[model samples]
Structures are given as structure tokens and as C-alpha cells.
Target: MRQSPALRILAGTALALLLGVSFTQAASSTKAAAPESSESFDYGTVDSFAGAFLAARTAEADRDYPNAIQFYKKALDFSPNELELQQRLMIALFMNGDFDEGAKLAKLLEKDPAVERVTSVALSFQAIRDGSYAKAMKSLKYEGPNDLDRLMNELLTAWTKVGEGKGKEALKQLQDLKGPSWYSIFTNYNIGAIASVVGDEDGARKAFTETVTDKNGGATAPDTYARAVMALATLEANAGNKQKALDALSAGDELITNFAPFKALRDEIEAGRKPKPVIETAAQGAAGVLFSIGGALNRDGAEDTVMLYLQFSRALDKEAADTLILLGGIAEKAGQPNKAIEFYRQVPETSPMRRISELQLGLTLAETGKVDEARAHLQKLIASDPKDVRSYLAYGSVLSDAKDYAAMAANYDKAVEVIGPAPTRNHWSVFFQRGIAYERLKKWDKAEPDFNKALELNPDQPQVLNYLGYSWVDMNRNLQQGLDMIKKAVELRPDDGYIVDSLGWAYYRMGRFDEAVTELERAIELKAGDATINDHLGDAYWRVGRKLEATFQWKRALASEPEEAQVPAIQAKIEKGLPPIEADAAKVNAEPAAEPKKDDKKT
Candidate 1:
């Protein structure tokens, strides 16, 4: 079953702290190391150490890593003994892509517990790169601040054991490293990878099979699941089980449909060629460790920290399309769409992920206001592969954002045609989107059935329930059923402010002014900055005879950037209160009340 949007967001947030670094240890150590002085670089030549320090801190806060690095260096010149400065500088250097310099500084501060976690991870990567297996193991031996840290320490240590040609010991280490439920996928995948490299096909197959079947691990750590599938496929291919290898690839496709490596291996199998091993060397295995953890952290919204680990992985395996895609995603999340474009552009054209990257690049371009270029790019994709639902979805999404409802509806119509009439549960989104487009175009007759079809395909989808129910209420038809649906939607997605607003608005439409005021107030609290909800609350307040509060809310709505078409009416409401009930009633009685327009924004 598909996870709800709210559930996904909550999961991501919860997982963000899963790999806790010992912040308390770092903080206490930082205080003790603050006052030391060194004679390394002359500082008297510079006028104000305090000013440079403040500027460096400000730059760090602003994420200007380059400037922060420069300023921190200048500050360090004056106070070479300051451990805090070294720690900040090392982080700044790392973020600025000067890993060598960062590692060097980290080595000097290796004994300081405050920066121990960061320093240890950095120095270990350096040692692993230099073929210093013993040194890498030593660096990883230090106690980590959190469960995530401890898990990584053990995993990396196992990889180091493999590096030292102790494959049995490495497997033993992984077998014994107890951790949270989420850690099983990583450990098993690593064990499978190590066994593959050591020619223990049976062991590799058993480990990979367990990893593949782990549902919790698969949902929480999809990249590791994908890797485990690839490892299993490689083992099967080596055993001359061509069909089994193909089946393994198919299974992986269900987790990551566009993974380039899996697609490459599947092609080799189809052509009756022996596929290369998933992990042939200890170095690559170690790189995979970093890549898996980094990908998981990125999903958990720790983009800044994940980027550094991914860079380390990329340095080891430059051709890793997964790492590149992840980096692009991180850049996009950080609001560097142009940087994201560069990363996406770097995906090798032969990779299946390249198509997904192109889609991302097109979307990023549209986000940057290059709508024409985005449209052309997506149109070309559609022309190249008319059967690719993603291309049509991307094109339709761009049109939807641009408020071109007609074009959006037409695009989805094409998608529906491509998908044919035998729509499955997976095709529910297409119907739902088409419904939204038609509804936005004010074609209620066409829109309502599509929504119904979506509900038929995916029963109890809260978004569909909220939208269809709200429409029914707005039109004053099926009032009780509409209210029931809205209530059910609220139950399903209690935290959705838009759905709550719909409930409040339904009450207002029924002229239950007191009830409307109560629900609308709750809705406003839930969606504090929403112009439509605020306006709805204002109308409800006025109906309840709270003229002053109504005017205040109308003014707030005006300031909140309501639709251009809505501005004049809102402004008029603010300047002059709503017309009297007698006049409104007379008008309503003279002309049969037309169905009220529903809000354009969907839940």
C-alpha cells in the first residue's frame, strides 16, 4: 500500500535523528577548547580578531561556506590553538569540497572529543583511500555518540576487515553487530556484498534473500534493498541461472524502477552475457557502505551532512549513478536548481537513471522560470517515448502549475489514452489529476465522475474524499453525504489544514454561522497564512455579527496575496461590509441560486 503524504513526511522527520551524532559531547568539549593560543601564524597584522570571527560565524549561518572558510582561516591565523576554530574551519573546508584540507585539520584535532565524531569519520575515509586498513580500523574504534554513529562504525570496521583479507572475520563482525530494526538491511546487504567478493555464493545468496524479503527494511531503506537485489542477481548470473538473475532484476525494479545499474545488469543477462560482480573489491564495498547510509540520510532530510558522505563515496566510485542522482536531489532541496541541473546532466546517457535525471532537470528548469525550455524538453521526451507515463505526467504538472487547466486536462487525457481503458490501482493518480484539471476548468459534470473513478480504484484516498465531498457541499447537493465524506477525510488526515478549511466552509455554506465560526477559526489556526481560509473565516465572522473581526480578517486576506481575481471583491468587503441578509435573500429568491464556486486549491 502507498503511504500517505502526511505519513511520509512524519517518517522522514522521525528518521532524521536516527543517526544521532553526540551533540552534547561536542558542545561540552567545544567550551573547554575555546581559550587556547598558538604561535603558528601571525595574527597581530590583522586588526580585529573578534570582527573576523563574527563575520565567519555569520557566513557559516548563511551557508556561504567558501567565505566562511576564508574568514575562519584568518581567525585561526590569530588563534592557532583554538580547537573551536579548527572544528568550524574543518567543517567549512569539507562543505567547500576541500576534503584533503579538511581531513588534515581533522587529524590534528583527533583527540578532541567535541569534534571526535566528525574527525573520526573524515580520517577513516582518508585512511581507507590510502590503503591503510589498520589505521582506518583504529579511527573507527572510537565510541560514537548515537545509535546511527555506532552502526556506521561497526559497518565500516567490517569493511576494513574485508580490506585486510579477513572476509570471514568481516562476516562475523556484521553478524554480531546488533542494532535497530532499520539497521538489519544495511548489515545484511553488506554481508552479502562481502560474501560475493570472497566467492561464498551460498552465503551471499542467503544474506541477499533475507535482505530482499525484509519489508520494513525495504520501505525504510530502498537504496539498500536495490543494492541487495543487484547483489543477488549477480550471484545468480555467476551460477548460470539466467532466469533467476532476470527475476532478481525484476524484483529490484519494483523498488527502484529506474535504477541504472539494475537495468544494465538486466540487459547483460538478456544478451546472455555474464554480468560483472556487484562488488568486486573491498574499496567498492566500503564505497557502497557510504552510499547506502548517505542515501538513507538524504531521505531523512539531513542533506548537508549526507552530501559530505556522498562526496566521499563518489570519490571512491566516480561512475555511481545513484550517488549522482542523490546529490542532485539534495541540491534541488537546498534551492540550488542550477547546481541540481549540473549534477543531473552528469548522469551517463547510457544509464536508465539518465531519463529520470532529465525529468528532474526539466522540472528544475520550470521552477527556475524557464518554462518554455522546460516545455520543449518535456515535449521532446513525450515525442521520443509516447508510452512513458512520466513524460506526460511531468508535462501535465507543469501546465497545472501554470494554471493552464485546459492544457493540463488535455495532457492527462493523452496519458489516459496511452494507459488504455484497463486502468489499475496504479492509474488512480492519473484519474485524480484529470479530475483536478477539469474541476479547475469548471467542468463539474466531467470532473465528478473522474473523482468517483479514482475513489473506485483507490478506496478511502483522503485527498479524493476531501475534494469530491467539498465540491458536493459547495453545490448544496447531497449535503449529509458530503458532510459525512468531509468528516471521514478529516479523520483520515487530521493534520491537513486544507481539508479542515473545507469542513468549515461547508458549515458556512449551510448558514450555520456559529458552527462555521468555530470550525473556521480552527482552520485558520491550522493554515495561518492562507488567504482563502482567512477570507472564509471573515465571512463567517460577519454572519455572526462580529463586524470588527470580520473587517480585520478581510484585510489580512487581502495582504495574504489572494488570487488576482479575488483581490477586488476582498478589498470591497473590507471597505464595505457584506450586503444585508434581506437584500441577499430577495436576490436569491428572484433568481434561483446558482451553485457556488468551489476553491481552486485541492488538498
Candidate 2:
């Protein structure tokens, strides 16, 4: 089973119950007409209790915590004793950074077994804030579920022990931690952090040394290991061993390539600046504990738990940039672009990760359909550091989202100019993206050379191989070599249905009907509900004289929602069947009738 699966289930049936029976349906019925301002629209501006609850759930599902909190409160007022409503409201409040408010609701629900999961965390955090170490320990209890909750409880309890001035005791608790092999990195890192907080420098040094020394641990838990290295390096630097500090950071670099924190810390030590301790308080150490587990919990279906950990970490140390960035990324991936923008905007201006967050903010704005705003924001970023290739990339991404291929090409042209003529393998994406823009603009002469240049820099790149190969096949030239390139792409990315479809489509273009049918069927299995894949399969089936199956596939494509531009053509094919063949397979390839679409579907 997946780690931390039970973490989100702490609230019992609140997730489903709070969401109620009518979320989008009820919420859609309550949408407001045009407001006075062009800047905002309120889905929560509704008339009934059901509407309020539905709006709250719709917002919650979207991760729009601020709006969710407002609507949940409105719903709660209508039915005060609703356990699921109260529990969900608390979660929304916590997620929106109103930790104290969320905790207050948890306080009332503390004795309820169903609400214990949220209460355990909320109450423990409140106790930690109030400096009641014993109360914190008592508040953190959960016997159900897997070991993840138990692990978090123990770590938080250990931090309280550190707060109680039992530093040695905290270290012992961590040393004594028992769980799966995956627990080692977090355990060792916390042990070192507790030791540092207690001023046991030698103990801290030894534990951190051990923590970072586990190269396999570093790979599994790179962020935790990187922090352990920084902490170890700080201990050395403060003790007047500057070279040792540098060495620790150098080791960190080997473990996690180009971590900004390590780079910054190393620069400080090299410039004779004494490094500060990475952990200044027990609370900060506890934050790291959350981050370790929370970072590991980041997966597609586990976002709620991952977000909970990061949000709790923020409650302990509000300005922690790493927590903020991770939270923003989770929001982004969850399709809550507005929520993602809020989190990204919170990363401190002084943070090394500030620029990265800003880039994310711009992309999220575009996702939210604020294309003009995104472009303006990225334009300022690009102008501020004209020589930075990342700034150009961020700007280009906004242009790509806006479908302004000309602007995207211009952006990459500037990136190429900034990098000068000595472009390395690292610069392959710049060439590849520029090539896409040129191809999208129907300038294949320009696009082809850039694709070749990209492959020269990174010969085995699957995307470039697929694009160039597909283009050659579509143009009726270099048939065998083009097919070979596509085959190579499929070999490199066996599970990628898009690449598989390219291979099938290439065979269809060459009139190899049987082979096309086989590959297209595989592509359909891999990428179900893809209109383009279904359409291609339909065409391939028709050529093989499986007319009945071909008709079924065409109807399937229409049901999958082919683009508006493609609907009439698909309908006509279904109505009258494919036109009669004018030539045999070889002749068809020798004189191509039309270019196959390069879009996920072709024209």
C-alpha cells in the first residue's frame, strides 16, 4: 500500500459528506451574473444553505481554500452541529493559513472519534505553540491506520521533548524510532537536528555525518539529506573548520545536483562568511520533520496528505520557502491554479527560490486564463535579466499558452543569442522548442534544421526523433530512415501512447494496413478516449477491409469529443465511409496526398 494513505482519511467521511450529493450541479445553478468588476467572479454568491454547501465543496475540490472557508462558514451557520461540515471547515481554514481558527474548531471536536485525525494534529500544534510539551505529547495519539501517522506523532512528540529541554531525550527518541527502512533518513536527520538544538555539537556532527553518508538515503530523500549536509557543514563552520564546511556542501552537491541552498551555503563559506545553524529552534526542527514525510507523500492521489504536511509545516515556520514552494506546486498539479498563485506569491523576496516561484506564478496565471497578465508579468521578468535563459523560457511558456507561436520563436531566438554560439547538451530544449514554434508556423525549412541541431546536441532525445521522423514520413521522403527514427522513439518511451500513435500513423501513411491496425490498437489501449488515436484506428481498420469495426471506431472518436474543426469530417466519414483508393501502398507513399496532422491529432 502507499505511504500516508490513512493520513487524509483522518476526518472519516468528511471529504465525501461535506462535498454532499450536489457540488458542481448545485454550484452551477447558483453562479452569479456579470458583476460590476472585471477582476473577479464569485461562485459563492448564492441564496440557499444547499447552495452555500455546494459552493463550499466546489471551492474545496478546486483547492480554493480562501473561498472554501467563506462558504463553509456560511453553510455551518445553517446547521451548527453538522460534524462533517465542522471538520471540513476546520480543514479549509487550516489550508488557507488560518491555523488558529482551524484549531479552535478542532478543539470542540477533540472528544469525537471521527474527528480525532484532525484533532490530533491541530491540538498538538496548538500545544507546541503554547509551550506545553506534556500537553502536546498527550494530544498526539492515533492507533488506527498504518505507521505514517504514528511516525509523525512520534517525531512531533520528540520535538516537544526538545522544547522541554530534554535534548538528549529527543535524540534518544529518534534513535529508537522503528518502522520500515524508509524511516532511516528522516530519523537520522531529526536526531542530528535535535542534537544541534541541544548544543551537542559532536553528537550533531556524528548524526548528520551518518545521515548524509547514506547515499541510498540521499537518493530516496534528497531534500532531507541535503538539509542534513547543510546542518553538518554549519556545525563545522561555527567551530572554525571552514574547509570541513565546504567539504560537506561539496558532498551535498554530489547527492543532489544544483540545490540552491547548498550552493548559497557553499558560497558563504568560500567567501569567509561564517555559516549560521540550519535549525534555530525545536519548532524549526519539527517543521523539517513534516517536510521530510510530506515531501515523500507527494503523489497523484495523495495530494491532500502532502498538502496537510506542508501546511502544518507552515504553521510552525511561516516563512519557510521550501514548504511554500512545495505547497504551490501541489496546488498547481491539482488544477487549482488560483490557489497555486496564492502560495507562490508567499515565497519571500529574499529567498533563493523566489525566482522559481515567480516563474510558477506566471505559468499558473496563464492556466487560469489570465494570459495578458501572465505575459506582462513574464515580460518584466525577461527584461530584468535579459541574459538569464530561464527568464526567456518562462516568457516563452506564456507565449506558448497564448498560442502566439511568432512570439515564442522570438523568445527562443533571444535565448539562443543570450547563450551565444557554444550551445551544449544542456541547451537542447531551447533548440527543440524553437523548432516546434517554427513547425507550428508552417516554416518546416527553418524547423527541420533546428530539430537536427537539437538531435546533434542530444542524439537520443525521443521527442525530437519522433517529430522529425514523423515530418519526414509525412513529406514522402526518407521513408525507411523516418520509420526507423519513430521505432527508436517508441523503444525509448514504450509506455507513451503518443509516440506509439506516431508509429501507427506512419505505417498508415505508407499504406501498410495490417501493421497500422496492430500498432493503432495498441495505441488505443494505452491512450483510451483520445479522439485522434480512435480516428487513426478507424482509418487503419477501413483499409484492412474491416468496415464494420472501422465504423465503430469512427463513432467512438466522435463520442470522445473530437475538436470542433474535426467533427464534420468525422461525421461525413461515418455517413459515407472512406473514398476509394486511387493507388497501391507504394505509389501512395511515393506521392503523398496530404500532410498528416502534427497536432496530437493531424490535419
Candidate 3:
């Protein structure tokens, strides 16, 4: 083991002690022989000090702090200038909680750098506890072992100020630190608490936001963000924005589930009462932690971080509009439609981001089969902005999804009317959608022109090509041209299951069963579990004389309920089996396979 500098000092003292002992004996003899006025000290003092030092060491070894302190103090009194003895005494006194004596001894021996640096910090903390603010502050000013130690002293100073009922002053001291560390944010939150106590709502809000939003600000915890949210809510409530306040408070409640401050604030808000001052104060403290972490987590994609943020956000703010919207998206991604709805509902109708929030909310609601509510929100959006092409398009899209051809066509017309003469890709989408609405309604005359217009506007758009080609094939008209269009679509979107299915279906319609089988098999690879793709493959297989395989594929497709509109038709097909192909008809007229024995059941 390496020898410490102090240990080296002790080791070198033994030789010096030998010389000193001989000199002291000679001086004492000379004084005793020739001097009458001056008295010589005996070796008794040295023996007594040595005895005390041994007693202190024995006590320290036994972990008896009280006995160690007494023995060390007696040794120090006998040999006051012995640095090592004084050091031991100070340590033992501190260990015994006799900080007053320890601090005094440490100061008296301040020339020792270690004593000055380390002991001063301990002394300062003790001074604060002893109600000597000035002395604590003075002790804190001395240099220390590390930054953490220095920070501890600084924190003690702040505590002293707080004890003196100067909370604002104490907060100011903490707030003055600008370092981007955990401690810095913690200090800012402390400042917020002071500001709140002084009725400085604006100051509190600013501090809270700084802790929460600033990427490098000191605050860093979910609870901190919750506090910031609650603080903001209180400010809004005080300013008469009742709904906004409720939203903010509710959101905070959701974020800070375990914190009492958020719950207290929530209860007050719910009861139409003002938050108590202490609630604000405590929340300010939590805000420091919450904002510091929440801001970072907001961008971190780790599931754990996101989940932590989610849980914390839920605790602090129940109706946090922005957080709710974000959480809603996360919930939807996690396949929790109900949870998503709960979050999306927090976004206010008057919010500038309402359109986006409402759109997501409507979609999630529709996923959960709350179609009426989804449509109502869509209608509200349309009513508010009749010329908003997005609202019209969304409403029309939803209607089309429900297979409500008449309503979808009406919405598509309004979308087209508002988007007249616009030379954009969106215009092409509008035309294409309208054509689909017409086609679904079986208005072939109306569908044809719009489809042609869509093709002209967005040349070679694969979806449009597939739709037009599939329509021609379905009607058994222009088979060659329909096949050509579908082949082009297949080339453009080889992996698109719907387009691939259309290409295969077109081939089947033209009685090119081999080509149909190839495309349908490829479609199944691209879109496994797609009911339509499975159904198309089954038809192609039957046309190619794969009767048993066709039956299996058809059963799989029938089991897959793709959407509400397709469910009934697919179920009906499952009950009745697929339409007879030319190959199947030939087999029926030819011969059947040999019947199995009664004991040899089908595997």
C-alpha cells in the first residue's frame, strides 16, 4: 500500500524525536543546576500525553466515539501543538457529535491544508445546524476537497438563509447557479418555490417552463414536469382561462400520479377552488425534477424512457393537451384504442393544433368502432372550415371506408369544388377518390370521366391504373386493354398486394389461368393474411385445376375479416364456396377421385 503524506510525516518524526529528547534532558539538567527563576519541564508531561494518545487509539479501535473523544481531548490539552494529536481529537469530537468542539479545534489548526479544506465544510454544516448563519457562510467560503463538497457548503448556505425566513434570498442563491447539471435544475425548482411563496405567478411559470422545456435546464424528472404543468394551470386559472386551466391541471394530474401536490391541485381545480400556497410550493420542488427529465425523454425513443415519461406525465397532468396528444399517438401505436381516445380528448377544440388532434382522435375512435363520434368530429371540422380540402378529403375517405357511396360522393364533390383548378397531386387524389365513390355506387357513366381525368392529372398513378383496369375486367369489357393497364400497374408497384391481385384477377377474367396463378401467388407473398389476396389466389388456383388447394385458400380468405364492409360478403362466400371455374366444370363432367375407406378418414 502507498504511504499517505501524513503517514510519511509521522515516520520522519521518530529520528527528530530522539534528538529532541536528548536536547530536552540536557536543557533540564542545566536549568536545574544553574537557574533559580526558570523551571524545567519533566518527562512526565510526555509520558502523560503518550498515555492519553494510547487510550484514545484503543477507544477509536473499539469504535467507542465518546471515550475516544475524551481521551483525544486530554492528549491535545497536554501537547497542544501536536498536529496529529489535534487532528485525531477533531475527528473523534465530530464522530461523537460534539461539532462545536471539533469546529473550534479545526479552525485553530487551519494552517493544515487538509484540516482547512475538509474540516471547514463539516464545520459549516454544523454551524448552520447550530443557528450560526454568518459563521456557516464564512466556513463555506474556504476551499474544499471537490466540487460536490463545495456544492454541499453552498447548499448549506442556502439552508441558513431559509432558516432565517429569507426564502426568496435563499432561492436567489440557488437560482444564480447556471451550470447544466442535475443540481442546477434542482436549484431552479427551489427558486420557483420561493417565487410561488411570494405570489410571483409569472416568475413561477417562467421558472417551471425553464426547468421543463430547456434541454439543458437543471430540472429533470417526471414529477418536475408535472409540477410545471400544475403551476402553469394555476397561472391560467388565476387568469380566468377555466377550461385551459382544467386541461393543464388535469394533464399534470395524469403525469404525477404519486405526488400529493398534483392531487391537491387537482382537487382544488375540480372543486372550483384555488390551490393552497403550500401545494404550489411543493409542486415547484417537484417541477425541478420533472422538467429536467421530461424534456429529454420527449425525444428519447427507448420504450423504457417513453413508458416512464408516459407514466409520469399521466400522474402529473390528467388533461395535458399536448402530452395527451403525444400519448394518444403512442397508445395507438401500442394498439390501445381506448387509451388513445382518452389522451386525444384532452386537446381543446379551440387549440390551433385542434385539426391534427381531432383527426387522430377520430381515426382512433373509428378503429374502436365509435363510428358516430368519429363522423361527428369530422363533421365539426368540415362545418368549421368548409373550404378546407383536408377536412373534405378526410370525411370523404371515412365515408368511402364505410362503403357509404352516396355520402362519400357528396363529400368528394365538395372537395373538388373547393379545390377547382388547383394543379397539385392532391387534386389528382380528389378526382381518383370521387371516381371510386361513383364506381362503388355503380354509376359507370359518372365514374368513367373522373377516372380518365385522374389518369390525365397523375399519369401512371398505380392505384388509379389498377382501379380502372380492375373495373374494365370486372365488367368483361376491353379485356386486352384492361390487361395492359393492370400489367403496367404491376410493373410500377410489384409488391402492392391490391394492385398485384388486380393484375391476377384481370388475367383470370381473360381465361389466362397460368398467368393469373403466377401473379396471385406473388401477391400472397407480398400481402400474407390479406383476405382479398387470399381469395384471388384461390380463384386463380381453381382456374388452373388445383381444386383441393383452391378450397383451402378460399377457406383461409373467408376466415379473414378484413374490414366491416367486407366481413358479410366474405362470410357469405365461406358458407357457399367460390364460383365454379371452367376447369372445375370440366372436372365435374369428367370423373371423381376414388372414395376413401371408412377407417381411412381424411387427414
Q: List the candidates' TM-scores in order.
A: 0.83, 0.80, 0.45
Query: lDDT of all predictions, in order shown?
Result: 0.75, 0.76, 0.59
- Score candidate 1 by lDDT: 0.75
What's the best-to-worst order under lDDT? Answer: 2, 1, 3
Ranking by TM-score: 1, 2, 3
Greater TM-score among 1 and 2 belongs to: 1
Model 2, span 282-400: residue lDDT tens: 88877777787777656666677667778878888887777888888887777667777888899878564567777778877877889999899988887876766766776776676
lDDT of 1 by residue, 265-343 (tens): 7877788877666468787888888788776655444676677777767656666677788888777766677877888
Candidate 3 regions exceeding 4 Å error are 1-323, 478-481, 561-603
Compare candidates 2 and 3 on TM-score and give the better one: 2
| Model 2 accuracy (lDDT, Cα) | 0.76
